[model samples]
Target chain A: MVIRPIVSGFPPNMHKVPVFADHLMLAQRFEHPFSQELGLTGFGLVTCLEGEAQFMINDQRLLLNTSSFAVINRGSRLMINVDETPARPVLLFFRSILADVVAAEIFHRQSGHDKELSYAELKDYRLTEYVHYTHASVKEVLEQAIQLSQSCASFQALKTDALLRSLLQSLGQENYQAIAVSARLPVVKQSTRVDLYKRLSHTKSWMDEHLTEDISLEDYADMALMNPAHFLRNFKTAFGITPHQYMMERRLELAKKLLQNTRQPVQEISEQIGFDVLSSFSYQFKKQEGLSPSQFRKQVTTD
Target chain B: MEESQWSKFKLRVNLNASVEEAYRCWATPAGLEEWFLRDASFKDAAGNAKDKNTLLQEGDTYQWLWYGYPDSVMEKGTVLKANGKDEFVFTFSLGCPVTISIYKEAGETIVQLVESDLPTDQGTMLQHFVGDSKGWIFYLANLKSILEGGLDLRNKKEELVDVITA
Candidate 1:
């Protein structure tokens, strides 16, 4: 399939806008399976308007149909595959500053106060990958954004900003609802609930910072000021995943980045992410990603 | 075909509130008065007066007044449909159909307003389409501000010009 670049440059007069850069591309026709390693410079939202697409982030695989979309953060390695014919997917990339604004709004709404958080700090708050099912309203808003980007309308920049804010807000609410549902409990005191959320956030941040180290459940539990068992349960309930699962996902994510961006050997990359043995790391990577480390690297690098 | 192509004004906003909370703001009289109108009341299909605090249901008739508007100036409409907490369809000034949809996205509530079935006459179209579009934009912004920041940016004074420079 021939990849058609629709809009590759930033809006010339829109420098003052929060979006630093934006690009839109369309695949003409999918004759053969295509894959590309996306070293995204900022936050990206990719929607499949017509056919199917596949995205691999860390060891997680997401399939995008007409109703589904993916949001990927910067500094992450993404492998995208298009196998279906007549696939027309649009990808929009925006600066991390825009993401930080959304993150700050969410934090303020949930925590009741705005804390100064840098782009890096906000990036750490993102899920490994966000895959959402779009309703008609969201689809219309996204379609409008694409239309505005393609148009030369004088207010296109402002219009696009408004649409993006709307999109981000929707995505934020979806994330919050997911957490609320997973951590289903009766209404508790606001102060206690906020404290619990803070502790959980700290635990996740701690995990991100120590992805390369040998960490224990006791350490995470202590960070949350709870017993090991209780911490494990609450963490799972709040995040919809156990502490071990979260750590493994983070390690794999780091390993994928090193493999794609650097010339590090697979064994060394494994060790860098806290894997002790080469064979075990390779086995686990292959089991989760459906390809060995070298093979995955070659697949991305050659394409 | 030409009439079917009448201009439609649509606006979307993501609020830092839940779907239920956002829906309430538009579905109930008290909720609407909080940020939208000055005085709002409704009656059910059976002509029974519905409490301002309760959610409006399908076939409910609404009488709405803006703060700066005179006592004689009031807008009347019917709640054509209210689909749970997700969608509410009602009639606005000049009988234009206004559809409000609320859905949870990411962790935020997204509220979308689409006003359609407008007059096709060129003069009427310009008056309602352009004028109401601008008004809706301000009202929507006020809705977001009031819900998220607890600040009402609406002009409650009668003498103040409501011109919003975008």
Candidate 2:
């Protein structure tokens, strides 16, 4: 009957209804960055809308920028941190019962009922920890689910049931993509390939947080706990792009956003994205965007 | 008019576009056509038709038609308030007032819609309260998709009937 916030509360006294369709889907928007060690009760999709945030889950520090999101598993302790610049994050937490039901449905449909025997217990939501981009359908459906979380709406529980199913289904697809993406590594064992891919992904996330710096390949290899040659080859194989190429892509993406949004000069924006020389930044920007940095700014402002 | 408990509801969507773009989507006749209506025409107080690109004023009366529906199914209403930017209020179904608020929130532009005041009889309650709420949710989602991703989720195929899309 009562709703309590996750920060500075005894515990989140969220809905615990019995039915899966009536499952509790609660959303909490954090106005400012927070720092606390709290245990999660269900899957929490943490999205950084404005600023950067650090989520420590299962001893891994995952940095979420505006372009990325992270999923926190149930029963995992999370430590959220934000610096002087505040990060606005929205968390969508759903009861495990909802995920379990969706998982059962997915498995039952995948394995038709003509089987001779059936397992009494269905699979639970044991999604592995990972960070993903906002382009995922999970993010889209999460936004839809958030709209129904309003207090004044009726049949919210009924409405959210469909969103939950789609969200879980999207997560299932994401997990499948994760495995498929890891298959890019030429390792003989699939488990080794997946584990190596996760490490490489973690390294890439670290570079995302520190985009403005000139990080060395040795440092990335060290962080990923692999030899530099091995890391470079596997990173290229798993992601289909070398680390440097991926870094440049992300840096330019950030540069375009800065150029369009802020009044910063071209040189300043160029340096902000880690281009030591303004000329090279402009060259790269023009190559990727088909327009010069100043030209892009002018086009945006005029439009 | 007796105000019933279930006559009004509010919904909002965070758009990837700017506040100016969000306002344009709901304020002008041509703007409404971009994401919402198939055709929109606004007239001044003197019954003169306003320009399609003209920003709607507070006293303007408007007629809007949808894409899938017939031209006979026009919605006639008057603009209640228009600040030329960021906010718009207009009369909607059954003369109910719909308020639109657009502002920057957490680095994204948000379009907040509140539709209120309706005849709370059984039929009107179901049509406006439940039906309109559900309808606005889809429209707002469609608006976000159109603005953010340039993908219109509307069911533009006239051959298809009984769809819940735009």
Q: Choose the strongest candidate by DockQ.
A: 2
For residue A73, what is the lDDT in candidate 1?
Answer: 56
lDDT by residue (B1-166, candidate 1, tens digit) is 4655566778999899988889899988898998888888899989889998898898999876666433334567799899867899998855678999998888888999999987676644544566667668878888999899999876577444223421
lDDT (0-100) at residue B5 of candidate 2?
71
Q: List the lowest-lDDT window of 10 residues for candidate 2 chain A.
A: A116-125
Error of 1 at A167 (Å): 0.5
Instruction: Residues A9-75, candidate 1: write the lDDT tens digits.
Output: 3343432322343233343335556676554334566667778888775454777767766666555
- Model 2 lDDT at residue A169: 61
Relative to the true structure, candidate 1 reaches a TM of 0.36
What lDDT score goes with residue A288 in model 1?
Answer: 85
Candidate 1: deviation at residue A88, Å? 1.0
